[model samples]
Target chain A: MQAGTQKSVLIIDDEEDFAHTLAERLSLRNLAVQVACSGAEGLAFMEQNLPDALLLDMRMPAMSGIEVLRTVRQKYGMLPVLIITGHCSQEDHDRAQELGVQGYHSKPLDFKELFEQLVEVLHQK
Target chain B: MTDKHFMAKNLASSTHELQNILAIIKESSCLVEDVLQINGKPRMKHGDKLYHSLEVIGEQVDRAKVLLRALNSFAHAVSDGAQTCDLVETGKQTAQLVERFVRLKEHALQVVVENGSAHIACPPEEVIEALHSLIIQAITACTPKAPVLLRLGAQQNGQALAIIEVAGAAWNPEEMEQLAAKAGGSVVLAPGVCTVQFPCAASL
Candidate 1:
């Protein structure tokens, strides 16, 4: 993906408001954005469609981000996955890093830095 | 784990959800700002005030998020059965949890934490509960509008202590000593300072 070119990003977070807001922000930045409110929904969406990059949350009720990441990696290898979480333990962080997450960030997010990473991740793809 | 443990877990999890709500509010407000900026700020009437209001909302959301995060961390402080914990972080969490309550009574609670960890091995929840109670008592005893200070530090004997200072208030050393003793600690109240020295890890 070329820099400044339109890219599609999927944000998987259980918080509807956060996902919508992030989607709006990404869209404003000129990137196509899709939001899934749960890990299961995100996985279901990924089964049929692959975005340029993914933004995933760490903690969820039924299915966790780690579980989603594991499944995504096995099913769709090398797709850029960025872990965005508000509550994450160091153990989870190390595990996600080992799982080949492109980047990791904590909330409240730094949208500027997140956008730059999104662009970079899309470029990598 | 006891019922208290279950309650702490619930509180921590709730904070996570609360944070998401705050994030959404912040983002929605940001979207409004984005629209205002894209439409050209100078062209719209009352655009400046509207933008300023959005900014204020955003600031409050950010502030709420920080408090929620601190509360969340504090809730999880009890996750582990008695273990070593940083006194500074514990003091901050204790203050954050009850800040609103203090403010409701028209008083301020200022928590000042040192950089280094003053590690203490004990039931963090119990210690926090005891210290929090002592602070509240001290705050009640203090004059109106006086700020209560919760300061954490390491003692000469490598023990951890939380100093709850209430300006212009006289504390009952004997009562505070009893409170601290119940939590496996000791207290020294002088004029306006209530020092709570936690039990050593070895004792625990």
Candidate 2:
């Protein structure tokens, strides 16, 4: 995974507009981005594509972002995940950190910070 | 305890409660103001687009001011310790407060009031504010152009509740359920729509 390369990113968030908007932003930044509107869908998409990075939303319906993170780690060990959430409770932050999330951002997202973090993550990967 | 000690303790408790209520009102008002200011800012740097965005933002801020006033009054009423208030009216007012967000996103909001006029004994402001947050969450959960159907009515058990239903093409039941759980409620998804019910008692 490298900057300016066609690296893929998977976004799992229930907020459709926010997810699409973020995907569009990521695409503009030269990353191939695919969005899943739920954790389940994100997991399914990951199984198919195995993206370079995953931008996960912590709060989602049937499957939570944490649950998705655990599943991804179990399947694809050491995959980079950036946890994004609207309500960033202490519990969620602690859990995400404990689970070894590569990056964490709170909503409403600051695109500049997110882009910088994404670049760093991609470089490391 | 002696009368003097009892009176002093009562005064101290009342003062503490009032301070807490004021803090809540202040915090909520600050959030409302921030939302207005953020949404009111120009979306672009270009002259004409900036101007148009500012104008739209001004209108939204004005609308938000009205809502803030209503919220302020409601807060006052609750702080005043009003024993009997109209819960249904409070619910409607709360819905209106968050209606701006729905309209801003260009979502069609269909509010169905099944119960004409039912009164419940509770702090109207708290219930209204909670409901407003719930509606805002519901609106945010949907697609920009999707219709958000809100049903405000009394439950079969005579407990007032507000039901927000959204039928987006990509409505995720599990995501909604998680959101509901976070909001201290639950969500049920049907064939066409997903509904989140916030009971009045729970709000209290």
Expressed as tens digits, the lDDT of each residue in B54-111 for candidate 1 is: 9899888878877887778767766545465667777777787778879987888887
Q: Candidate 2, overall lDDT? A: 0.64
Q: Individual DockQ of the candidates? A: 0.54, 0.01
Q: What's model 1's lDDT at B101?
A: 76
User: Highest lDDT among the candidates is held by which one?
Assistant: 1
RMSD of 2: 21.8
**Candidate 2 lDDT, tens digit per residue, A2-101?**
5647888998988676677667656756799999999889988887899988899886879988889889889999888998764444467788888899
In angstroms, how far off is B10's CA in candidate 2?
30
Residue-level error in angstroms, candidate 1, position A101: 4.6
Task: Output the number of the DockQ-best candidate.
Answer: 1
The local lDDT score (0 to 100) that residue B10 gets in candidate 2 is 58
DockQ of 2: 0.01
Relative to the true interface, what fraction of contacts does candidate 2 keep?
0.00
Chain B TM-score, candidates in order? 0.85, 0.49
